[model samples]
Structures are given as C-alpha cells and as structure tokens.
Target: MNGANMSARLKDKIICITGAASGIGRATALLMAREGALVVATDLQADTGAALAGEITQTGGRAIFLQHDVTDEDGWREVIAIIRARHGRLDVLVNNAGIGLSGPVVEMSLADWRRQTAVNLDGVFLGVKHGLPLLRQSGGGSVVNVSSIAGIKASANAAGYCATKAAVRQFTKAVALECAAAKDNVRVNSIHPGIVETAIWDSLIGTTQGARGTRLEALTAPSIPLGRTGTVEEIAAGILWLASDESRYVTGTELVIDGGRSIA
Candidate 1:
C-alpha cells in the first residue's frame, strides 16, 4: 500500500539470498534488510558480500555475509548450518546466483553448457534441497528463483543460458507443487527479468553492439516497450513482495519483470 506499510511488510523475517555480492542479488539483500529482515547474504565475492552485510549492519539492520559458491554442495550445507545456528529458522530463500553463456547451440562447447547449468540450474536445485528443511522448520517460507526472459522465449546465440533458465522456471514450479501437496506452506516461484542494468547484463552483452555507450543506454532503456532497462531496485521490489506475507496466496507462478520485451 503506502511506503510505511510496505516497508513494514517484511519486518523481522529471516531471508537468505545467494549472489548477494552484486547486481539484483545485492539490491535484494539491501532492500530486504531495510525492510527489517535478518538477511544472510552469500556469494563468491567475499569482500563485496561482506561489504554489503556491513552496510546493512551500519544502518542498524540485521545481516550476515557468508562466502558461498552455490555449485558446491558442501557450501550449501554450511550455509544451512549457519542459518540454523544463528536464526534458528529461515523464512525466505532467494536463489539468485547465475551465469550466462552466449553462443549459438551448434557452436557452444560442453564446458559452456556445464558451467551455465552448474551455477544457474544446479545452484537452484541445491538451494531448494538444503533450504527446504529450514523453511519447513520455520513453519513455512518462500523461495524465489531468478530465471530470465530467455527462459520463456528463444533468443539468438543464448542457447545454454536459455536452457538453464528454462530449467529453473520448471524446477521452481515443480517444487511449488510438491510443497503445496505436502501442505508445507512453502511458496516456490520464479522471476523472469529482461535486460536489467546489472553486472550480469554487462558481462553478457558488454562486447556486443551498442556496448560503448553509458551502462543505461547501452544495456537497454531504448529497446523495450517500457523505454528503459529494469533497475535492480525495481526487481528487488518484486522480490520483496514475494518474500513478504502480502504474497501469501501466491505460489508456483513466474513473475516476469521484462518491460514487455517478450511481447515485442
């Protein structure tokens, strides 16, 4: 509803987010912390992740930074252990760690496919597998998987990325159904974002056409119906909604924040 009310929606919730070092993950971590959640931020970038946690703590928000490589099962085990030991419960998990491989399918290497899947798809699987018990113990929570517009529609020269994202979308739905059937109160869903002005976007398309311009103009803001690339804050807002009790009845759905690009 209003700012004060919306800001209080997630008060005191326990949220664990992957890829919290930069991009959408960073945004989500900060925003959720500001919303009064005890945020546990994790990513491969230890310094940056810890910096984000520091910023939150400086502002009097509860936060912890953990060095995490989402592809590592041992790392996931440690993450869960930390959550259990510290918060004693987990109310939300945002699976946001991902990488993009942009080559035509025929020209794509096995290594490229494996890398993308390992981080993008396998990471999501591990998050759900390990986070489920904590979420269940918490009497139910939400899981937000960050997919991509590529997951829904075919894109040129992005076969591996598309396939992994597509798998994430389906996996999210499947997990949602399972949780629903079990009456676990766990909500699992996916978010499909279009070209967002994040490091991930830059790394994926930085060398392509229009790469020399400012980040805003180069990445998007001109190619979509919305007339701009989605901002990390915008996407984080959607994530906050999904994590909060406001979305209590919502589950097993894909929320597309693509600026209507898919329609174009």
Candidate 2:
C-alpha cells in the first residue's frame, strides 16, 4: 500500500513494546508508530532505543524511550506507572524481549536455564500481570507475546530456549482464558517466529567456524521450506495484526510466522 493510503490501524493507541532497540521489536515499533500509535519503546540498550524514539518523533510520529529490564518486577511497576501518568491508559503491550541460550540439555548449566526462563517466560508473566490493569482501565486491549518456533518443535541444542518459549505459549492461552472468564475485552496471543534475520542468531550460532552470514544461511537452509530465513519486518507484521483491532476476535492462539520451518 502507498504511504498515504495506508490505514492508521492503531491510531491514537498507547503501545508499549519491550526489547524495542533491535530486530523484530524495532521493526514493530517503527511500523506501529507509522500507523499512528503513541509508541513507548523500551530496551536494555538505552542509546539505540532512544535513537528509535527520536527517529519516530522526527518523522512526525509520537514516541518515547525507556531503559527497561523486563525481568525486574519493580521496573515493570515503574514502567506502568509512567504510562498511567503520561498516557492515562495502555492500549497494547508487546512482550517482545527475550534471550536465546542454547546447549545440549546435559551440558547446560542451571544458571543458564534460569536466565533464559527469567527473560523469555517470566518477563511475559510480569508484563501481563502488571499491564493488565492499565489495559482494563483503557476499556480493554491486546497483548502480543513473542515466542519462537522452537516453542512448538524441539531442538536438541536449544532445550532451554524451547522450554521457555513453550511456557510463554501456554501462559498466553491461560491469560486469554482468564480474561474471557472475567468478561474483560482484552485479548492475548503469542507469535512464534522462525529463523528471522536478526542479531540474535549471532549469539545462538557463534561465528568461529566461518562468517556469520554464511553460518546463518547454512543454519536455515536445511530446515526452512522457503529456502531462506524470514525477516524481522515479516514477523513484525504479524505482531501488528495481533496488536491492532484487525485481530479483535483472535485470542488464546499461536500465530506462527516461520517460513514453513515448523512443519518441515
């Protein structure tokens, strides 16, 4: 669609996105802002997050940035308070912050597992726990939790990552059911992205053997039916649908944005 003809799907909505400094989170932040949402972009990388918010403002969109550590309950409280004070209500929350720690289950340390769970699974719980009130105050909204394809399919070297993402998927369903039972208008869903072209791959597969680009292509070629990795923008598009009113009836579901990798 042309820029002028594009629908403002999230116009005037208040959206808070975690891990907004880079990758799918970054892409989502930009797209949501363009669609007229008041974007609050948060990430551990203060400089990059600030730059993203600044870019949105310079382009005539409304946005702000905050350094957020999603694992901290106190930090979440502060973030919600900021939204309440500034925007009065939150219309959407994207729990997109996550880490990928991979190793054989036998070789992985307890600390590693705990860290992965803390960010990927626990962070989503905290976001829903704290953000729900504001969403209700806004008269109901949506929550999009970013999981992974590993959540549905298992991988030998990524036991911890898979376990945490799987937990996120179930947690999303539980929250969706709870909201429905309570007669709340809020909807909850999870997005499982396959091999997206993001920097996370660098940490998942180290570059010692060859160039990072070559390693990434090799990693995705064998399994992905599309013969290539997905892009952050593609994943963000699904997230946007979940966050916007377009998916008003969708809840307690998993939106897989893989290149048919999970099926293959």
**Best TM-score goes to which candidate?**
2
Query: Model 1: which ten-residue window has the lowest total lDDT?
Result: 1-10
Each model's lDDT: 0.89, 0.92
The TM-score that candidate 2 achieves is 0.96
Looking at model 2, the pairs that clash are none
What tens digits encode model 2's per-residue C-alpha lDDT throughout 1-264? 235634699999999999999999999999999888999999999999999999988887889999999999999999999999998999999999999987779999999889989999999999999999999989999999999999999998998999999999999999999999987899999999999767787778876334766788887778888888888899999999999999999999999988999998
Deviation of model 1 at 228, angstroms:
1.3
RMSD of each: 2.9, 2.0
